[model samples]
Target chain A: MKANKVLINTLAIAITFMTLVPFVWMVSASFMHQGEANQFPPRLFPETFSLEHYLRLFISMNIVRYFLNSVLLSASITGLSLLVNSMAGFAFAKFHFPGKESLFKLLLAAMIIPAQVTMLPLFLMMNQLGLINSYFGVIIPGMASIFGIFLIRQYISSLPDSLIEAARLDGATDFQIYWRIVLPLAKPILVTLGLFTFMGTWNDFMWPLIIMTRESMYTLPVAMANLSGEHSQDTELMMAGAVITVLPVIIVFLALQRFYIEGIMLGSVKE
Target chain B: MKGKRLFKVWMSPALFLAPALLLIAVFFFIPVVVSFLMSFTDFDIYSLADSSNARFVGLENYKNLLSDPLFWKAMHNTLYFVFIGVPLSLFVSLGTALLLNSKLIRFMSLFRLAYFLPVVTTLVAVAVVWRYIYHPSFGLVNYLLSLIGVSGVDWLGNPNWAMPALILMAVWKNFGYNMIIFIAGLQNIPPELYESAQIDGAGRWQELLHITIPMLMPTTIFVSIITIIGYFQLFAEPYVMTQGGPMNATLSIVLLMYQEGFRWWRMGYSAALAFVLFLILFAATLIQLHLQKRFSTV
Candidate 1:
């Protein structure tokens, strides 16, 4: 029994180390000076760490611009989506409009259709709207997603109806009730949904690759891809770029981890 | 009061649904419909200049797609990815979930974060990172393999290994998501059942086999279906890394659709490919639903 316990403990430790090693190695390699990473016997610790590549990325490559773009785009998408989807979610949860169930059912069915199917014509539509290569192009398609609405509605539905009724009885307008009452109560899921939207927008690659034509409009992911294409040989610099692109998301996830993990379970449990 | 009540009722839903419905219709639904229309017509470079140039070909693009060996190759490659990648990912996720949920495990959050790190990382960045990591000589993977006395294998350069390499990276990136879901399911399992099994003199293996697996069926189904849907939409990894090459071994349906739509300006043909993919996906979704229903009833 003692031997079995020892074996299980060792197995657990080994698995944890294996899971963490890639990320640890990535961070370690990012900090190492050029060519120091590819050393024989694989130095897990940097003999000489430097911020030269990071400085070069900011100075030479305009990586900060891409970072700003990711931030701006992700924030805009989140803020707008929260407003839009929260309203819709509130309605779906509380309001008894005709065809509410059918409208929602249709949206749920539409979820099965992959976003890629719409890419071709969405590109054309954006081009026609003079939105191509603009932030609006990327932001517009993602402004309101069915999943976002569904998530918000699920959370909103669980809230007691008597609260909203009380607001209505006290002469709060429908919008006022949503903003003042439901919104405050639904804050947790809103944060969860916002983080989800923000992370998704930040990490998105395909649509941005399609919509944003010029180098100037590129998000961090797109810029990283472009950088890899151009500077495939500069492994250290590329690692630095990867580090920059991935770091914000990791930080965000770590900071709001409780909400994020709960959000995942919530989303998965229903559908 | 009635007027105010009616206005409140109509306005709330309208205000709420309008934005999402509008965006979904304009950006998602309309474009999908437009793509369906586009698949039937000869929409190409000339059509971009003048819409009049696009003629209704009436399934010519579909016919051409059927005959195209490149499309077949892409289809074969995609199926290979779906079939192999789906089961492998499921197994890995289930394995990790089992390990993580084990009573002997400590520092669960630390391990969970480590496993899930790849899921949240930017795909382009990871692909770029993995491109180097799959580097035959300098790669971490090869370096580790060499410790076991195995020679370095050209992971990306070799056509045979290229898709498998992509599958490996993809699995590594994605398995954590399903693992989390499975962990939730595992945790949800009633502890009393396990205790009951223990009192019945059931061994660890028997308890897991009889108790855990049966309980996890619904979650397993959900994970597999979503994983399959996601695997079919493989685009960014190959786009960033291989551009669907060493002889199109890694070329996927979406990548092929992308080339035909954007790169070559064969929009109509690409639209056709998109519909066919949609059809295949629809079928897969139905199968998943069917399986779930069957399992539930049984």
Candidate 2:
């Protein structure tokens, strides 16, 4: 039994180290000087920790612009999606209307259709709307997702209907009840959905790559992809760009991981 | 009075649902419908410049797709990925879950988080990182291989190795997600079964075969279906790391569609390819569900 325990522990630790190697290498290489990351034996830690790559990324490559673009785009998508999805979710959970069940079912079934199917037409639509190369091109489609609505609706459905009824008895308008009562009660889910949206928008590549034609309009992922293409040989510089692109999502994920995991569990368990 | 009350009840929900429904209708539903229609027409770069240039080419694109060797190649690659990648991913996930769920393990959550870290990171960023890691001469992978007295192999540059390299990165990136699901599944299994099996002189492997595997079947199915669907849409890894390169060894259906639709502006043909992908996914999902039902009945 003792020998078995030792074996399990050893395996666990070994797997954990292997799992973390890429991230550790990414961080270490990002701090290495130009040409230093390409050295013989592939140093796990920089010989001299330096921010030269990050400095070059900021000053020469103007990654700050892409950074800010990512922030703006992700934030807008998160905030707007929260409001739009939450309102619909609340209605689906609380309000009664003709065809509500069928409508919800239709939306649920639509999830099977891959987003790639819509890309070509959506791009043409955006072109017609003069939204091509604009933040709205990305933000608009992201404003309301069926999955977000489903998540919020699932959460809100568990909340006591009497609360909404009580607010209704207090002469609150539907919107007011949703804004003043339901929104506050739904904070945990809102945060979960918000993190999901923010990270998704931030890390999104294909759509942003398609929509944002201009270099200035590029999100972090698209910008990073472009950098990889243009500077494939600059290992340190690419690592720096990778770090910048991935850092915010990681921070957000680590901080709000409780809700995120809860959200995943909630999603997996059929309602 | 009754009519007014009915109107009020309907209006409230409608008002709340309007924005989301409208957005979904316009941005999602309409585009899907339009893309379906567009697939029947010869919508190309010329059509982009002038809408009138597009002509109704009934099923020609699909017919051409049938004959296109590249399409077949992409189909083969995608099936290769889905078939091999799904089982490998499930095995890794199930293995990790079993290990992590072991009572003897310490700091399980920390280990879980470490394994899951890749799942949360941006794929494009990780792909770029992996690109460097696959570097032949100066890469960490080759360097480690050298320490083992194995000669450096060109990971991404060799067509034989490129797909496998992508598969490795993908398995590394994704196993944690299904691990979490499998962990949940494992926890749900009644411990009395294991104890009963032990009392019956059943060994560890026998207990796993009889109890754990059967119990975890639903979760396994769920994970497999989702993994298959996700893998079918393989794009970012190839786009970022190899660009379907080393002589198109890593070319995926979605990448081909992207190249055709966006890069070359062959909209109709790309839409046909997209529909074919959708068909494959739909069929695969149906077959899985059918198998699930069969298993449940048996």
Clashing residue pairs found in predicted model 2: none
Q: What are the per-residue Cα lDDT tens digits for candidate 2 across B2-29? A: 9999999899898889999999999999
Error of 1 at B163 (Å): 1.3
Say which docking band candidate 1 falls in: medium
Report how closely model 1 matches the true complex, as a DockQ value: 0.70
Per-residue lDDT of candidate 1, residues A1-271 (tens digit): 7776677667767866766666677777788888877665677767888888899999988898899999999999999999989988988999997788998999999998888889988988888889988999999899988998999999999999999889889999888998888999999999999999999999999899898879888899999888888987777788889889989999999899888888889889655
Q: Could you tell me the C-alpha RMSD of candidate 1 in Å?
A: 1.8
Off by over 4 Å in 2: B295-298
Candidate 1 chain A weakest ten by summed lDDT: A15-24
Each prediction's RMSD to truth: 1.8, 1.2
Please give, for residues A1-271, the per-residue lDDT of candidate 2 as tens digits: 9999999989989989888899999999999988998878788898899999999988988799999999999999999999999999999999888899999999988888999999999999999899999999999998999999999999999999899889889999998999999999999999998988988888899999999989999989999999999999999999999999889988999998887777777777754
